[model samples]
Target: MGTLIFNLNMMKMMKYRLLFLYILGMTVAACNNDLPDELFVKRVVIAENGFQDLRLEYPEDGTVNTQITISISGTSVLSKDVEAQVKVCPDTLDDYNYERFVQDTMLYYTLLPEDCYTLENEGKVTIKKGDEYALLSVQFDLSRLDMFKDYVLPLEVSSVSDYEVGEPKYRKALFHLNILNNFSYVYTPSGAKVYNSGDNDDYTAWTTDLTLSTLNYNTCRMYAGGVYETDTDRDKYVIQVTVNSDSTLSYTAMTPEINLMAEGDASQNRISISESPDLLVQNKSVITTTLKMNYSYTYTSPEGYPYHRRFEGTFTNDRTVFRDKDGNIREEW
Candidate 1:
């Protein structure tokens, strides 16, 4: 009986010791909660493509309030203060040329330590426990960007836990911007038409109709004999046609008041009739008339269709003083 009682007592003592050790381990873990493994960013929200703001939480879901807070404990793994910093750069260096073409510029964040917290360009930060954690705030401006295409901004963070002072480490973050296209349409030609509405797509030599010849992939040339407008709307037509050189001609076209960045650009060459007396003759005699002409034009728009311009003038034998249909000297004579 005595031996049995002694054995039972030993077994109870062992169980008690085991339970005590487990409770002690739990207490130590709770006190060392601010260890390196426990310390981390809880939320990383991107305000814009080029800006990433960090949110650190303690004890889970603890709001740092307009500040980035890191917890550190003196007893456990992260027993030392942390050091942190951030760095940033453009995502596509090769696309820099395109950015310049569009007048897009780059900007970087100038970080300042908020509430007396220290923040360095290297992105080093420090924090401690029982003291409202240190906060880091970052400010950036990107309003200068006119347009963006497949661009990225990268950020990195380096920090060291309390106990590990010498071994500094880092984490990375990123922001993005995708600016769309910016362009405008000033003027464009629809197609050409003449007295003969046949499919005049091919013409070795053309007259009267003033067919435009294809100059290049994007250009065409024409000398219209009859009356026509440079625009299909016919709101504006060639006022006076002066034979330029053998293959080219200089003519003035009337159009709606133009609003453009640069005046007198090719766009200003609308087709219109000048009320000047030299171009507006009356009672003209019909003689065997021949109009020798050549022209080449270009398409500023995507479509290669030649914009039409109306050419109106009476056939005349006397080249010195041309007569309008009214048999009077042309206006501006």
Candidate 2:
């Protein structure tokens, strides 16, 4: 969205830079008036749209409200209101997918289902007199959507009451669903012991946090066995953990160099949530996740000595999400 026209004149001095910018602005103003007098025109456009990501906080009540704005482009403001017709355009989504991923079919976005969302404004927008844009409202039922699916709602300004329907490529857009990423970040790790099981020498507190990296959408990878991870052999101590739909945990060893296996009460390896009665009712609430696991791995040191270690503990991540006075959630935490 930002571009710098690196001209020698503009770079000469600060004063020259300001003057160059003024001249450029004047040039752009003159270009707008270059349209032939015989063929005057007004255009309705949605910025070049392949996929516009809209963030959703995973609202607790299952209901979500959002809006999109459409704008008109012209040299002069309209004296009267202008109406525009909008509709779901599947072909536009197709063009985007084909252009973006010709053969990588797996990454293409799926069309949002009808039951998941409701177009509250029906498909019409009226840009009022002296206004350049109008808003179209939408509501969504989060329970009906799959968190793993890449969903997009394709829309286009199909017709305008007076102005031209913009450029063919710029007229349409896709609203992509973007959900907050979960369960991957720094979490406090405690009650976990790290030591050379063979020598019984404790290496506890070698690392302070159970920092996790994304292994997949549903799983995270962390340093296992030797919690005191070094840059060179970090991959050798890698372990992946996944919280399943049934609240059970799944574990994996990324490399064979680390002898990975479960330990202690395997059945207790699960995710537990701390829920509040006033959850979404209070306009703001806290979310805390505690991951409990019992696992062990053996790492062979550079000197050909093997250090068998056990990682038995829980990692906790806690944060508060606040909602505003206008009922909008500020959930970036």
Candidate 3:
């Protein structure tokens, strides 16, 4: 009787263990069927390296209106239609917010005015079944904006239908636009051929060098150099040119150097503007200005006597085909 009772207890324990294992396998299979396998709006496609910055130019002579297309791509082909809503909203990471949150801030951008830009996609775009992308078109009126100001447009994904939003970083796109005035071109000189009757018989060949001291849409400050010899003798001059109300030009150069004279002993240097060139002319690349300068400088001769001289000449500087030191074309403003 004792042996029969022990056999019955052993059989009961084995049966309970098999029942527990069978239930666990069924529960795992049910969980696998409930996993998600749907599509989502991944990100906005930008032209360069995922950066959504756009630059538009406003010409001085003609009216310019720009149109740009914004594309949103999905993670996978949609089994059903998915609609995404886009809106012009205040940037979450604006200048004030960025300064409070970011640790190492370098630059800050101002928000663009809503009245200067318009959208034409009805505020919503749709990705149909079997499609993977949607587009939103925006237009900017360049004439309405101030040319000297900088602006930014912030766009956000407000909502979506039948799909989930993507990564937090890709949910919003920022567009940076800069408006520049008419006289923003950098005028670089190639070289100056000095006309003189003193050092090199009648005329001397000299190379001209220029550095931009101050630059803006309304004014340009430049320091010009003319080398008569290797390093023994040279002329240093500074000029500030401003755009007048009539779209003409006026300049102020206190120390205008006339490369002809060798030495002088005067304290004041005077500059007179003769004519202004039209910058909008397409074929006209060179500017010739006849300037009268009453310059004075002192130099010691071998006999220990100071020499003085005064002269005037026509200065012609061709728009130095803009190029970098590496011989590459520079980017336009």
Candidate 4:
């Protein structure tokens, strides 16, 4: 009798399982096509809502022009014109950051200051009759931004004249602008090889990818020999370099700890950057920039041992520049 009751329970559960699957299939089919038009009707939205990562190369005029697109989403275009207003809604920043970071305010994103960017279209966008999209122009001033700080340009389609604005999630844009300088990049795109000598010893050699952080338009800072990025005494070995217009570079130790320094030839450490002719490799033409450095410096190690170190190698990078006729150019190489 128990065996028979168990079989009955199994059959009953199977019937309910099949019924649930049938209902789920019907709901999915309705969502796929049979749903009412009102549910999927067109709504005005900032096309680039969520986030956008922008790399700002050194602009020709110190200003980079960017655009935001606003559109009406639906199966067809609206018959009438629609106007949308965009705003730098920094007030909404706190809530956005809170959602992403919870209570960790230290890691929260920061708003890009007003002086750093100019909204050329004054937050106005118009999709004319028979059109579905419009653009708003914006320009970023490189000089006004801080290199070390993370900035997010928070924007929203605050109001719409015709169609209803998009859902809360689709109405805003968080643009993360990454600014670049002449000699530094967020990526480790350059290689370094260092040859050292200490305590009257022969030579110790090592190689690494050079991570240079920009300090100015033409200068950057890097760790000594491109090593020990997190070393407590790293400041003593940190070097500030200035890439000159003549393709030459000058270096200065951040701390007096690197007491003695000189160029490879025992002169004031000034080196030149070399570039190769555009070459076709893997079906792409690229210009390679090489920084050939030769220098010796004296600094104490973490164990309190003083040593003289020499580095002689080439740090290389290559980038293809894309420019327009309107004085817009990016030569990161």
lDDT of every model, 2 decimals:
0.34, 0.74, 0.49, 0.71
Clashes of each: 61, 0, 1, 0
lDDT of 4 at 329: 47
Tens-place lDDT per residue, model 1, 259-331, is 1111132323323212223334344332222322222222122264444322122221222345666666552
List candidate 3 stretches off by more than 4 Å.
1-51, 59-75, 93-97, 100-107, 179-187, 191-333
What is the alpha-carbon lDDT of model 3 when measured against the actual structure? 0.49
Lowest lDDT block of 10, candidate 2: 1-10
Which candidate wins on TM-score? 4
lDDT of 3 by residue, 2-47 (tens): 9999999999998999889899989998987785553453554322
How would the candidate models be sorted by lDDT, starting from the highest?
A: 2, 4, 3, 1
Give me the candidate number with maximum lDDT.
2
Tens-digit lDDT string for candidate 4 (1-333):
999999999999999999999999999998779655545667888888887876766654667788888888886647788888889988777787888899988788778998888886688889888787988888888767666577889899889887688997899878888666766742232334444564435555555567777666787778777357677777678787777666667778877667536465423334333434335532233445556666667867668887667765566666665444553444433
Report the backbone clash tally of model 1: 61
lDDT of 2 by residue, 55-129 (tens): 764544667788878788877767789898878898888888888999899889899898988775687889899
**CA displacement after TM-score superposition, residue 14 of candidate 2 (Å):** 32
TM-score of model 3 vs. true structure: 0.42
What lDDT score is found at residue 289 in candidate 4?
A: 51
Better of 1 and 3 by lDDT: 3
